[model samples]
Target: MSGPVDAELARVVRDHAGRLAASLVHLVGDFSAAEDLVQEAIEAAVRTWPVEGIPERPDAWLYTVARRRGLDVLRREKRHREKLTGVSWPTEPEPDDRLRLIFTCCHPALPRAAQVALTLRVVCGLTTAQIAKALVVRESAVARRITRAKQKISDAAIPYRIPGPDELPARLDEVLTVIYLLFNEGYLSSGGDRAQSRDLTDDAEFLAALLHRLMPTEPEVAGLLSLIRLHRARAAARFDENDEIVQLQRQDRSLWDHAAIAEAGRSIARAASYRRPGPYQLQAAIAACHAEAPSWEDTDWTQIAVLYDMLVHLAASPVTALHRAIALRYVQGPAEALAAVDELESSLAEYHLWHATRAELLRELGRRDDAQQADARALALTANPAERSLLRERLNWT
Candidate 1:
């Protein structure tokens, strides 16, 4: 049903869709219209590229087609005609279109929920289904939120540019949220063929670094950068040679990047110097606790639990609570942690990690059948290959 050309096109689209959409939005000044132009260009490619073979610069070809279509739309609508004269085919030294677009989407005028949904959709190139899973909501709810958010952007005529210095602080929280979610998606990958995607994580790190460069005084930006680096430093130890998930406590400490971990520690110190504590800063501190530990048994669970307590005070959510419960498992005991986790069941019944965590606690409590059932539920809910493999092994189904 498909050919090499189709496969190549898919790969190109998958790799460059966010950059292309950002460029189109920059040209057309409409998020929804830019997306429509991209779809139209993709359709045109589907029809033409098969016969012509792939272009030497397929991304450029798609952008050219989409730009021309956007121009035509502008002419027909007779709106933003001024943008028509200023727009040209992009060349080298182009602005950071994706970053600018992220700021635009994270405007304070829009609801915070809509801001994150739109950025994840338009800037991160996540599908509605993927975003729904990440947000722990129904697909229909995600679709509606995205549609309304786009409409609100169009209606409000939000400028497609980065906010000024005076505006950055007001918009920083949502922007940080979007980037954090982007990194989280890459770290564990809510749903996809791969267990993880370095591309998404790399993109998030690049964006965070750029933000740090732009606002050097912003501690939260540094905190976020540190958080990402700390996680990436330990990434190599997260999986074994068999590609199965390796629990943090059981991972080889030798595989960890000590230099990067130390560098991240300095970043946390820098963020702390600002004395403007926030959720990201606290999270980075928690991650630093793990990264700085010489051994699993050397881990300072008390400090981690205290940090989680502070994080909960700043940003309370079911997921955050679940994570706090996990830290408590070491500080307190499995039974206490089990009680905390059980309270979240009604809220996190569909979440794979929640089930997986419960299985661990149940096993600790010597409830064999309950642990098996929970592991089975976790395997059913998750699409991640590594996690599924780990769960299967735990259930002795390997």
Candidate 2:
């Protein structure tokens, strides 16, 4: 408790660091330069906090210092002439560069992997080592990638503005995918010891909410919000006290968050009103069905299967097919599910969920030994200890 003060102080510093970078980069149009401003601002805070105490708005305070440091950096380089009195920079914060600062970090022009890392680093304020760990890469590799990416972006003169209407479609999909991909990592981690990467989930939700504010009327944005809310409503029941994975039927319905469920309902209605019928909207509908059902027996498996079928057609990813197969197992029975699973085995060989689902279906069909073996294979494949433990528990059912 004695040192909690320092922790709180650190939080204040970290919270404003990304915004500091965003503003600095917008003013200077340089990545490493903006980061330097943030570092200097942090260093200043560390030195000043014990002397001046925390300010009323630490963020505003950080912005002031970071801006000054940025100006100082410019002055040192003799570049202040760009802002001669007749052509002085505006006193108001540059919202356009701030927007582009985030968009560029997750820009579709960059590789998806690069987008994820940079978003976490520049926008989420994560350190390169933390980002490397999050992405399961070595710290040195992450450091090099970050350096190269920033240099390339600055060299290529990636514009610092939101996409225009003509350029929105392709860029938007990549942005949405990266956001959801981060959320997925948090919801049900594809790797690591934790059952869910709460940090990643929080970051994804933060970005999605930011996007919703930026594009309020956009149906796809509403779809993503709805989908995340509906899924998050079930978070309380995703695992049990023993940390075992709680299958939907076995989960406690009373634990679901009614407020979040209602929010998701409003979002779903908002998206459906658009009549766009995109992937996120369809997925939200599936979530809505599960949320609306009163009990396991009352759940609309048929409707969910249909949604998955639609998703398979639209996205055509192995992940979607895997979900559709699981839904079929519920609606059409284990034999049908097995046939669907068989189709995904080759492409999804490393996908632990696919193996786990197949094991369950096989067990339900009285193929005990095969079920046990499949479960074992899935347990071996997952780095998530929580998921692995859940698979082991399922194996015991054999």
Indicate which candidate wins on lDDT. Answer: 1
lDDT of 1 by residue, 243-322 (tens): 77788999998999999999989989988999999888899999999999988889999999999999989888899999
State the number of backbone clashes in model 1.
0
Encode model 2's per-residue lDDT on 171-283: one tens digit a residue. Answer: 77878888898888767763235433225666677777767777777788788878887888888888777766787888888999988998888888887787877899899
Error of 2 at 332 (Å): 1.7
| TM-score, cand. 2 | 0.86
The TM-score between candidate 1 and the true structure equals 0.70
- Candidate 1 Cα outliers beyond 4 Å, as residue runs: 1-100, 107-149, 158-170, 190-192, 195-198, 339-350, 365-370, 380-383
For model 2, how big is the CA root-mean-square deviation?
3.9
lDDT of 2: 0.74
TM-scores for all candidates: the values are 0.70, 0.86
Candidate with the greatest TM-score versus the true structure: 2
lDDT of each: 0.78, 0.74
